[model samples]
Target chain A: MRILVLGAAGMVGRRLIDRLLAEGTIAGQAIDVIDAVDVIAAEIPATGRITIDVKASDVSDPDEITALIDKRPDIIFHLAAIVSGEAEADFEKGYRINQAGMSHLLEAIRAKGGNYRPRLVFTSSIAVFGAPFEEPIGDTFLMAPLTSYGTQKAICELLLNDYSRKGFVDGVGIRLPTIVVRPGKPNKAASSFFSGIIREPLAGQEAILPVADDVRHWVASPSAAIGFLMHAATMDTERLGARRCLTMPGLSVTIAEMIEALRMVAGDEVAGRIRREPDAVIEKIVAGWPRDFAADRALQAGFTADPDFASIIKAHIADEKQRVAQAGA
Target chain B: MRILVLGAAGMVGRRLIDRLLAEGTIAGQAIDVIDAVDVIAAEIPATGRITIDVKASDVSDPDEITALIDKRPDIIFHLAAIVSGEAEADFEKGYRINQAGMSHLLEAIRAKGGNYRPRLVFTSSIAVFGAPFEEPIGDTFLMAPLTSYGTQKAICELLLNDYSRKGFVDGVGIRLPTIVVRPGKPNKAASSFFSGIIREPLAGQEAILPVADDVRHWVASPSAAIGFLMHAATMDTERLGARRCLTMPGLSVTIAEMIEALRMVAGDEVAGRIRREPDAVIEKIVAGWPRDFAADRALQAGFTADPDFASIIKAHIADEKQRVAQAGA
Candidate 1:
């Protein structure tokens, strides 16, 4: 199996690469070649059996996208995107990179014009759903994104379905929830605090809680997110029918509940590192997001979420431990 | 009002143009210049008060699209598209014209750049909703179009909402139901039979009924469709918020009910011109279409439907009578 990972420098992309390396195969096929692409140069993992190539490339550039497609990777993991805050603030850059970039990539693949139908696993987001929910958003709720970033993702989902339907590509879009305990520094996404409050505290650092404790949101662990992408790559797409996009299963937890879980997992000292600092802007932005979802379709299709917030914290701790051990070695 | 109507040669576009000429204005502004564009040159209506220019143009061409935007029409009625059957048969042409054409027009408008936010009235379709519907599909149902034509329209709807939200264009997309009692010859559209059964019979000609009489579908009269477009041009869009696409209200009637309405309006002689011909291809296509809709949002926004199928038949007769009178004069 030849695999290509876009946004390979990002946290999920890096972790996914590591997981792929450990498994040495996807869907039981041995890995022959792997291409990792990003705007910034991606790290090429040292491997003896598999050929690994890492390169800096912008998806927005048609030539760059064509170059990636030339390798004809069996599975393409498209995870590159500007975060919510950045997309909202920089309109042109956002649309160019997110919307036009995806379109260009799809067109490039189509231009290849052969029996080559690559499996494209795209990462969509829960941001695709906006506010004023009547109930826990179901699998069939309309996509009326309140933000530019969400709109870009929703549009890409439409493209994915269309391309798949036309036989140009075998596409599966997984609308991932806000990834809990994202193992990285704070990013520009308004929902960044959702991860910061947990990740920062686990590392013995003070993290700001921008919103009220009562405010709830849907989330999944990083491992679960990676799992969704891997499953999407190998799943029986015939079951998907025409609707190629699925909202992945996620745990719905309030800020207070997350803090409680943290306290349970890493004791009172780690949980105490969170500071309640009101950020009206972030609060307003998060207010328009979906709090919960009934992602029955994804669940039926064999996608799973984190068992609970406590387990999510434990998983993050374990990952950090592994990273430390590797660095020491 | 300087008006531009793409696909101005089509039945609805021609009728809309006629309605505009009758009113002498749109949104309370006098009609100064009206440009009608289509793949084939549209017939220029001879009018003393309004300056009308009809021309042949392919919307898929960026230069042609830019040329249309240069006119700076206050309201743009974008109704051009290859019907379902044609789109399905010719894949590349469908995406090029339906999808790329719409995108080019939006980009052209955005490129104008200096406070040029034209009121763009886009004609979407009920095809945006696929089969296996649960009761009446609502305004908030997920768009999972089964056909390439539906996929194109659904994608355009997303683009319309995004562009409107970004303040690039003031766009309102109306998802029209199957137009019944159409005043023209049969076309390749799968739903063409819906109009054919009523239209050909009214003209004292035999019409084929391709599916079972119990098969239900959503429909609206030509006049009602025009009303939706005109209202969309002038309606206060603030009520729409981020979701700009609306499923227009229409009569939900079975084939039996439609025939009954025709008999009631035009007598048994006209209704008897129908022939039962089970076309498997058309039946399969029509089966996947929307049967009914709970268009609460469009209704609340003041878009109305024909009270019943009989009224729709009567409206078609009334329109025919007016056309006859105008020709005689």
Candidate 2:
């Protein structure tokens, strides 16, 4: 079986590629080739067994998307999108990539008519739900995103279902929660602090906490996110019916819980690296975000989340150790 | 105020145009130019006081859409769309007109940067909510359209919210219930029988009832739908906040109730023109439609529905009389 991974340069994409290389199979079928493409090309030497092509490409371009789909990979993991901050700052770019990119990809696949429906696994975001939702938003809650980034994702989710209904593509959209302990420098996303507070302190560096300790948010570890994607790619979609999108199960934790988890895993000194610096702007934005979700459908679908905040922190630490060892090699 | 009406040839569009012409004002501003365009040109003679241009144009064409936007009408009533049956049968056409058309229009409006935001009144549909919803689908119920047309409308609603949020356009999307007793020949839509049963009988013609009498659905009069459009055009959008789309109030009645009302309004002889010809295909299709809605938001926003099924039949009869009078004149 062949696989295509868009946004392969990103953290989740990289880890997914690594996992695929190690497993060498999906849905119990031996893997043959993996075409990994992203806006920023990734560098990876392929194993002699499987053909891997990591290249730079813009998904917003219809022709480029068509060229990519011409390969007819058995499973296509679409993870490319403008980040929330950039999408909000630039409306045109947000729709072009986040909204239109999905359209172009779906159209490209549809153009290859007649029994050529491939499994297209798309990663949506919890941002799709804005304010005014009940605590622990149920599976049937409406999508009233407050941000352009969220709007784009919601629109794509609709298209994914419609296209799949028409038999053009076998699609599954998973709305992912914020990824905790991201191993990267802080970017402009207001929620970036969610990860920075965890990742920075683990590296013996200072981190900023812009929200109150009691403020709650939904999150999952990077490893859990990859598992969700894998399960989405291989799961039986017949159970999904017409509703193709599902909010993946996530750990709902507060800043205090996260810190306590950090202290338990890395000691008091490491937890002390986090400094309080409340920014009203970030706080207001985060307030509108979803705090928790009723992931009964997702859990029933056989997808799992980290057991607790401590498990998420432990997973992040273990992944960090692997990253450091790889860099050293 | 200058007004532009897309899909000016449709039943609701024609009625909307007529109402605008008769009223001679919107938001208490004196009427001015009205550019009426549709895929099929509508013949509407201006009242001599106001300038009216009715022409044939495809909204799917971006250049044509830009040209229309170049006029910069203060209020744009976007009522264009492929009906549910056509959209489902023709997927590409559905996306082109229902999806891309909205995108192009929004993009064109955005291109006219710096204080060029127009009040875009979009006509969405109850089709956005499919089956498996509660008896009365609330305002916040998730949009899980079972049809491609519903999917397209749902996507446009998201775009309307996002674009409005960005201040590119002041938009209001009204999710209209099915317009009952439409003044037209029978069409291929499964729901066409809903209108036919009332319209054909009232016109002293035989009509077919394609489903069981117990089948329930939501519906409103043509006049009520026009009221929705006018209210959407003039209402204070400041109250809309981030959520702009609203489910317009409608009378939820079963087919039996509809026929009983027809009998009361037109006498048993006219109602007796009805023929029971159950269609399994249409029954299956109509079964998935939303049967009711909780229009509390729309009511608070001053949108009203026809009082009852009898009132709806009376309104249809009144409109038919006017049409006959106009044709005779």
Candidate 3:
């Protein structure tokens, strides 16, 4: 099976590509060609196992996506988006990239008729839901997004469902919880601190705790996100019916609990690196997010989450070690 | 206050225009100009009270709405749409009109800077909610529409909410229940039979009942829809916060209850003009619609519903008499 990965330069996208290359196959099919694309192509070296065509393609442009879809990749992984803070700050840029990008992609895929229905896995965010949520938000809660970015995701979810219903393409929209222990520097996402607090402290650096200790959030590991995407790509969607989007399973942990998990995994010295400097702006933004979810449908559909926060920390350390070893070699 | 009606030729639009002219003022503000536009221009006579400019404008086009927003109408009523059946048959046409129209309108309004924000009252549909619902679908139920038209409406609802949240526009989206006792012939809507059963029988003609008598539905009258729009236009949206959409209050009744009400209002002779020639296609389509709704939020916000089905029948009779009287004059 051939694959197309949009936003392949991003953390999750790069990891997914590395994982796919390592596996050499998906769902028992020998992977032949993988089109690794993004707004800016990254340094993806030659994997002698399969053909990796790395290129830069603007997903926001209709003609660009039309050309991409012309390649008829068997499975399309669409993970491109403008982060929440950037989208909320620059309205035009946000809609142009996040909203119009999805619209153009779906339209381009549909235009490729003749029953060219490829499995398209889209990464939607839990931001699609707003505040005053039901405890353990069920699979059927309304999407009253609090931010423009969330609204854009919610609209894309609707479009994806409709396009799938019309038989234009086989689609699955996974509403991923904020991925914790995100590698690299902090981005513009409001929830970036969820990762920074854990990632920075592990590197013997002081991390700013944006919210209070009592603040809780739904999160998953980077590996867990990749697992969700893989399952979404191969799962039987006949049971999904018209509702193609599902909230992926995630671990709900409070900031205090995360700190305790950090202490348990890497001792008090690393956990002590976190400073409790509450940011009112970040606190306000975090207040409108869902604390937990009853993602029963996703669990039933064979998606799994990290057992605990400690496992997440261990996994992140292992991933970091692997990256260092690769660089040393 | 200057007013602009996007779909001024349709049944509800025409009635809303007539009601606005009759009232002379909204929220204690006088209407100076009423720009009535639609895909096809209708003969809306000059009432000599307000300036009624009737013209044809395709809402799907961005440039046209940009020009419409240039007028700076204080209150804009956007009830334009591609009906469910047509949207289901032609996917491109549906998204182009319903989804693109709302997007373009919001963009145009946002583009008109200098703090120009107009009150945009949009007509959404109950079709936004799909089947297997809670006994009475609440305001916060997820939008997993079964049809393409519902998908488009649901998407538009998200856009409206986001734009409103961003302070680009002051928008209120009212999810109207099925309008019963409709004064015209049945159209392409799967729920058209709900009105046809009441309307054709009152017109001394037979109407087809395509579903079981026990099948329940949420419904309101023509005047109730107008009331919802007027209230939406004037209602203080400060309390709405980020969620600018609400399910309008409506009476829940089955076909048997409707027929009983008709018999009480117009006698068995008029009600007996009913045929039970069930159409399987329409039955399956209607099965996926919302049967009832709590609509507590809208009620709390001062929106009212018809007291009962008998009142709906009585109102239709009164409206018909008024129409005949106007024609005679």
Which runs of model 1 end up more than 4 angstroms from their true locations? none
Best by lDDT: 2
Task: Give, for candidate 3 chain B, the lowest lDDT window spanning 10 residues.
Answer: B182-191
Pairs of residues at least 3 apart in sequence or in different chains that clash in candidate 3? B1-B30
Judged by DockQ relative to the true structure, which candidate is superior, 1 or 2?
A: 2
DockQ of 3: 0.91
Order by TM-score, highest first? 3, 2, 1
Q: Give the lDDT ranking, best first.
A: 2, 3, 1
DockQ ranking, best first: 2, 3, 1
Real contacts recovered, all predictions: 0.71, 0.95, 0.95
Worst 10 residues of 3 chain A by lDDT: A41-50
Residue range A205-233, candidate 1, lDDT tens digits: 99999899999989999999999999999
Each model's DockQ score: 0.74, 0.92, 0.91
Off by over 4 Å in 3: none
Which lDDT tens digits does candidate 3 get at residues A1-329? Answer: 88999999998999899889999989889999999999998668787879998989888889989988999999999999878888999999999999899999988888889989999999999989998799899998999888888998999899899899989999999999989999989877778899998999999899999899999999999999999999999999999988899999999999999999999999999999999888899899888789999999899888999999999999999999998999999
Q: Which of the predicted structures, 2 or 3, would earn the higher lDDT when compared with the native?
A: 2
Candidates 1 and 3 compared: the better one by lDDT is: 3
